[model samples]
Target: MNQLFRLPQVGEADAIAEPSADLRVPFAQSGTFVCKFIIGEPSDQAVCCGAPVADGKSWCAYHRRIVFEPARPGRAR
Candidate 1:
């Protein structure tokens, strides 16, 4: 069972490091339209998702879903 969930290989692990291999822009380098989705902890040192935002929104669609939990119709507030 452990084999089914092996730890990441050498190169794979580096992909998720700070300033991700996907070219995640640091908060300093970010433009207004970029997603404000923080990836890690320590808000001051955290990195944003760096994807474009949804229309007139602070975060991208993916991050929007995470940040805003839509209320279920029948659920009590």
Candidate 2:
């Protein structure tokens, strides 16, 4: 039945919005990091925000508008 397979209520949101995939940075040694957005239902998209860091601290980028160093001259991420 549709009810059995239906997904649980996520939250009050119309649709979850995508995150800025382009905003990526270098992760410590050789790895890379980037900011990501956690989409929810259709009513609210700002479910969660975070940036992949080397240390492993997933902060909320939505509430704490992330401010990273501008990409070098030509490089953009």
Candidate 3:
């Protein structure tokens, strides 16, 4: 079989570059947006993700990865 792929080669310049805020998904809903990850039973719910969002992000760093990055092949959500 023919080889079809090669690993990505990131350079120092690429790593040092600042990520553009425009690439992030915008939060359109009113009020403060929090990580949708819930805690406790439905009868007693709470928002314990972290501090209020900074830089106009929708979810925390953890949830942000889940929202943007593509899931690995053969892996369950």
Using TM-score as the measure, which candidate wins? 1
Writing each residue's lDDT as its tens digit, candidate 3 over 1-77 gives: 34333334322323433233333322232246544433333333333344345666756555555457644444654
Where is the poorest 10-residue window by lDDT in model 3? 10-19
Residue 62 lDDT in candidate 3 = 56
Please give the ranking of all candidate structures by TM-score, highest first, separated by commas.
Answer: 1, 3, 2
Q: Model 3, residue 51: what's the lDDT?
A: 32
**TM per prediction:** 0.59, 0.22, 0.31
* Model 3 lDDT on a 0 to 1 scale: 0.42
Q: Give candidate 1's TM-score.
A: 0.59
Candidate 3 stretches greater than 4 Å from native: 1-36, 40-44, 71-77
Q: Candidate 2: where are CA atoms >4 Å away?
A: 1-14, 29-77
Cα error, residue 12 of model 2, in Å, equals 3.1
Q: Give the TM-score of candidate 3.
A: 0.31
lDDT of 3 at 47: 33
Looking at model 1, the pairs that clash are none
